[model samples]
Target: MPVTDVTTDPENLTMTIVADFAAPVERVWSAYSDPRQLERFWGPPGWPATFTAWDHTVGGRAYYSLTGPRGERSSGSWEFLSIDAPHSFEVLDSFVDDEGKPLEGFAPMRMKLSFTPTAEGTRMIGESHFDSVEALNQVVAMGVIEGTKMAMAQLDAVLQDLREFAQGKGTQVELLDDTHVRITRLVEGPRELVWRAYNEEELMRQWMLGPEGWEMTECVIATEPGQQHRTSWAPVGDTPGEPFGFEGEVLLVDAPRRAVTTERMQGTDGPETLNDLNLYEEDGATLITVLIEYPDKETRDMILATGMAEGMEASYTRLEHEVLAPAERS
Candidate 1:
C-alpha cells in the first residue's frame, strides 16, 4: 500500500508504521479529524468501521464497530490522552464488548499519530506501544500489520474528497515596501471566527506552522495591549538544534478588527518588526491582511531570500484546509 515501512521493537514492545500521502498535511489530517472521513479508511477493505461515539478532546472516548463481509462484527474504543490538531495526538486503544465496556481479556495499548509535512506531501507515523512483548506479538498475530496497511491505502480517496472541499486559489503575498511585506488571504468563514482563529493560541498552532516537519513547541498569547506574546517551533522528529522562538509585545488590540505588535527573533541579533493585522468582511468571506515592517531593507531582503513567503503560503493553505474549511462545515 502507501506504507513505506513497518517495524516492531522487541525490547520496547512498540510497533511503528510509516506512510506518505500525496496531499498536503492539512488535507491528510482531515481524515482523522472528520468522523465521516475517518470511517472511509479506518478499517480493512472487507471490514468497514462505523463509529457510535467520537469525542476528540482530552479524556474523551470513542467507540466504533467493524463489520465483516460475512456479517461478523468487532468493536473497540479509544480514550484520548492528548490532541494536537494538524500535528499529532495520543490515545489509549482497547477492545470493547457490545456494551462499550473494555474487554477484560484484551490488553490495552497506547497509540500515537504524527503528521509531518513533506515536499511531496505529508508523512504520517503511527506508533503503538504495548506493556509487554507478549502483548505486542499477540496483536501482530492478529494481523494488525496487514490491516493497518490496507486501511491506510484508503487515505488517497479520502484526500480527494478533502481537496474538493478545500478548493481555492490560495493566499497571496506582496512586498509593500523595501522594509515591509503584506500577506493576504480570503478565508471562508465568519468574521468573528476568522478573527478568533488568529488570536487564539490553540487555533493558531494548527495553521501557523512555518515549514515541513516543523511544529510549534510553545505558544503564549495575550490579546491586551502591552501584554506579551511568545512562541517557539522546532523540527518534529529527533533533530539536533535549538528551537526558533519569537518574543513580542502587543502594541494595539482591537477585537474582531485589528492588532499591532512588535516581534523579535529569539537568540538572534535581529531588528524588531512591527506587525499590523487587519480583518475585513469581503462578500461572504473574511479577508485577512498582515503587514510586517522590518527595521531596514537589508533585513527584509535577507529574510525574503530564505523563502519566507513561500513558506507562509504553505501555512495559509493549512489555514484554509484545517481551520476555515472545518469551521464553515460546522
Candidate 2:
C-alpha cells in the first residue's frame, strides 16, 4: 500500500491523503498527466475509469467515468485552476452527470495535489477542501478514504513498468468505444514545438507527409474556433496514389495544448468526425493524444481498416527525425 495516512478535519472541512512512490517525481506526474496511465489506477478495483476528455492546462477540464462490475457508471469532472508541472496542481472536483454537467445539490470540492522528491522516491500529497462539515463527512461515509487507498495501491504496478509509457513506442491506437478511438504517439520534442508542427504550415510540410512517396500539396490552418482548415496530399514522382484531402471547422482551440475540430473528406457530404487533440510533455518528450469520434461504428471500422494507424506511425517517425531533432540541434 503506497498510502501512508488519511485524515479528515471537521473544523477545517478538509480531507488529506499522503502516499509515497518508488519513482521519480516526473514519472509519477506523467502517470497523472497521461489519461491512459491515469485511468489504470484512478478508480478502485472493479470500478475502472475511462477519461473521455483530458485537457491538461490551466482553465481546462477533464471528464471521466468509472464503471462498476454491474455496468453502472459514476461520472466526475475536474476543472483545473492552477498547474505547475512535476510539482503541484489545483482543481475544482465535482460529481457530474452522464453529459458531464455537475449534479444538482452536490457542491464541488477544491482539491490540490502536490508531488515532491523523497529519499526513497516521490511523495504525493492530496488535499480536498469542502464547503461544509457535512460535505466532508458525507464523502467519508461514502467510502472515499477506503476507495482512495484501493486506487493508489494499484499505482505501484503502473510505476514499475516505466518503459511501456515512455518514448519510442510508435503510434498506438485504442478503441475507446463504438464511435470513439484514441491515437497516441510520444515524440522527442517540447510540447510547444510539437503543437506548432501541427499548426504552422511551413513546419507541417516538412514532417506531416505519410510514408516516403508523398508530399503535402496544400495546408490551411485554423487559428480559432468556427474557422475552417484544409490539408491535401499528393503522391510525388513515380508513387502510385491519387490526391486526397481533409477539411474541417475548428470547434475549440487552446493553443500549444489542445484543439478540437470536426473533420470530413474535403468534398464529401456523407459524415464528419470530431478530433480532440491534446499535448503533454514529460522529461522533454511530448505525448500527443488524439481522440476521434466517428459518426458511427461502421465509419470507425472503415477508417481503421485503411491502414490509418500505419500511416500515422510513418508520419510520427518523420516528425521526430526530421522536424524535432533538427529544431533541438539548432
Candidate 3:
C-alpha cells in the first residue's frame, strides 16, 4: 500500500510498506532469514551489502553492512522483538557502530515484518517505528521506504533466481563495471580454430546457432576502431519473423592477441550496452574477456537486472564444450 499516513508522536514514528513476491511463504521466508540469500538485494543502488550476524530470537540480533563507493561501510543491526517461523516477525532495528553500539545521536527503531500467504504468492508487510516523531520525519525525508524496498527487491530477485537454478533454468547475474570477472580455460586447439570461433563464416556456421536460427546473417568486420562491421541478426529458432540486420564498427581489435572491438551500428540494437570482446593467447589457449560498459547508473542497473552476463557465461560454456573442444579433438 502507498505510504497511507505519515505521523509522529514525541516518542514514536512509523512507516509501512507492502510487496508481493511470486513465491510461497517457505521460499520467501528462507530468502528473508537465510543470510546467504539475504545479501543479494540488501542495499540501495550503488551499494553492496554483507550480512555479518543473524540470530532470530526475541533478544537475538541481526547485523549487516552496506559498502559504499570507496569500500566504506555503514552497518545496521536488528534486535528481534518477535519471530514466528515462515509467517511474521518484529524487530528493533538501527544503524550502529562496529562494536554494536548505537550511534550517539541517532534514534533506534522497532520494525515489523509480516509475511502473509496469498494465492498468487507471498505478501510482505514491513512497518518501521522510530523513537520519536522528529526521528520519523527525518527518515521520511531521507527515504527509508525507498531504501527498504531496494534491499527487498534484491532479496526477491535472488530467491527467484535460486528457484530457477534449482529447476535447471538459469542463474542470475548483476553486472558492476568496476568488478572484473575473468573466465578462462585452456583450449587444446590452435589459434586458427579459436579465431574461427570468433570470425570465420563456415567455421562460425558450424557452431553459430544459425542452423537453429540464432546466428547473424552478416557481420561487417573491419578489424580496427575506425572500421565498421556490417551485420544482420536473426531471431533464434522458432521465432516467427524475418531477420533484422545491423551494422557495427570495429572499435578495437588486436589480431596477435586475438581481440576485437566493435561499435554496434544500424540494424543493431542491444541493452544500451557498450560491449568489447577480447581474446588473449597463452600456450595456445585463448582467454576471452567480454567487457561491457554502460553510459551511466540507470543503464548499468538495467544491464545488471537482465543477467545478460550470466547468460553469456552459460552459453559460452556450452560453446567451449560442444564447439571448441571438438575442433581441438579433431
Candidate 4:
C-alpha cells in the first residue's frame, strides 16, 4: 500500500477514494477481471470474501459474500453498467440476501473505478455515488472508510504475490552527469492526458504536493515560452506547517508532446535547474521522459539528499491515479 486517500462529499452524495499500488495498470485491472483475485481483497481484514457467478463484462452480474470474524455473513452483488478494459468500469453495487436476492430497503449505488499507470506504479481511483446524503452517511457510519482502508492494504499483499509470480518493475532514474539527471517511466494513459496532468494547475494540485500531508495551495502555470510558472505548497491536516515555493519560466510548449522550463526554489541560494518533459504515445500508453539540469553538482547532490526524489515519485503516482486515470477513462 503506497498510499490511500479517502474523501466524502455529503453535498454531492459521493465518496471518492484514491489508492496507489506497486504494480502495473494491467495487473491491477486483472484483480477485478479475475474472480479469484477479486475475492482475495474484496473484503477488509478479518473478513474473508467468497465469490459466485462472477463476470467482468458490461451488463454482467457478480455475486459475492463476506464472512465476518463472528461468523456473520453479508452478501452483495454488482450489475456491471459499463466496462473498458485496463482503464475503467462502472457498476451498480447493492446488498443482497443469501439466496442472491436484493435486500429490501437497502439502496443500490453506482461506482466508477479508474486505473492509471505512473512512473512508480498504478493508481486506482474509485468514486461511489449514492442517491442521497442520508444514504451516503449511512454507509460511512457503517465503517466503510476504515473497511476500505483495510481492504486496500490487503490488496498490497495480493500485488506482492502477483509480482513474485512475474518479477520486475518502475521508474528509471539516471545521473546523466554531475549536474544533470534523467528520469524515465512508462505511463499507462493517453499522451494528451499525461500532458494536461503536467501542465494544468488543477491537475497538478492533485499530484504535485511534494510530500504526504502537503497540499498545493497555489499554482499558476503558463505553458508558453517566457511565461510565468509558479507553484506553492503548504502543510495540511496534522502535518507540520513548513511551506515551499517554486518560480519557473517556460522555455518551450508543445501540446500533448513536450515542454521545457527552468525552475528556481524560493529561499534557496542554490543553482536553478532546467526541466524538460517529453511524452510519447503508442496504443493509448504514454512514455514520460524528464531531464533536469542543475547549475552545479553540489547543488544537485544536496537537493537529492532532501529525499525530493521520493516525494516526486509519490506525486507522480497520485497524478496517475487521481488526474490522468480519470481523464483517460472519461
Overall local distance difference test of candidate 2: 0.87
RMSD of each: 22.3, 10.2, 11.8, 20.9
Among all candidates shown, the one with the greatest lDDT: 2
Model 1 per-residue lDDT tens digits across residues 51-161: 989898999999999765334688999999999988999999999988998888689999999999999999999999998988899999999998988778767756764
Q: TM-score winner among the candidates?
A: 2
Where is model 4 more than 4 Å wrong at Cα? 162-330
| Cα-based TM-score, every candidate | 0.49, 0.60, 0.52, 0.49
Q: Which candidate, 1 or 2, would have the higher lDDT against the true structure?
A: 2
Poorest 10 consecutive residues of model 3 by lDDT? Answer: 163-172
Q: Global CA lDDT of candidate 3, please?
A: 0.60
Worst 10 residues of 2 by lDDT: 160-169
lDDT of each residue in 87-204, candidate 3, tens digit only: 8888887879987888876788788888888898888887787767778877777776667655564454355542232223222233433432222333434566676676765555
lDDT of 2 by residue, 8-66 (tens): 99998899999999999999999988998998789875466889999999999999998
Q: Clash totals for all models, in order? A: 0, 0, 8, 0
lDDT of 4 by residue, 1-330 (tens): 544799999988899999998889998998878887777678864455778888777899999998653346899999999999989999999999999898987899999999999897898899999999888988999898988886776576456553242222345566755876767666667888888888777777788886688888779988778897888889887897678888878876657766777788866654688887766565566657677787899988987788877887777778778877777688
Clashing pairs in 4: none
Position 274, candidate 4: lDDT: 80
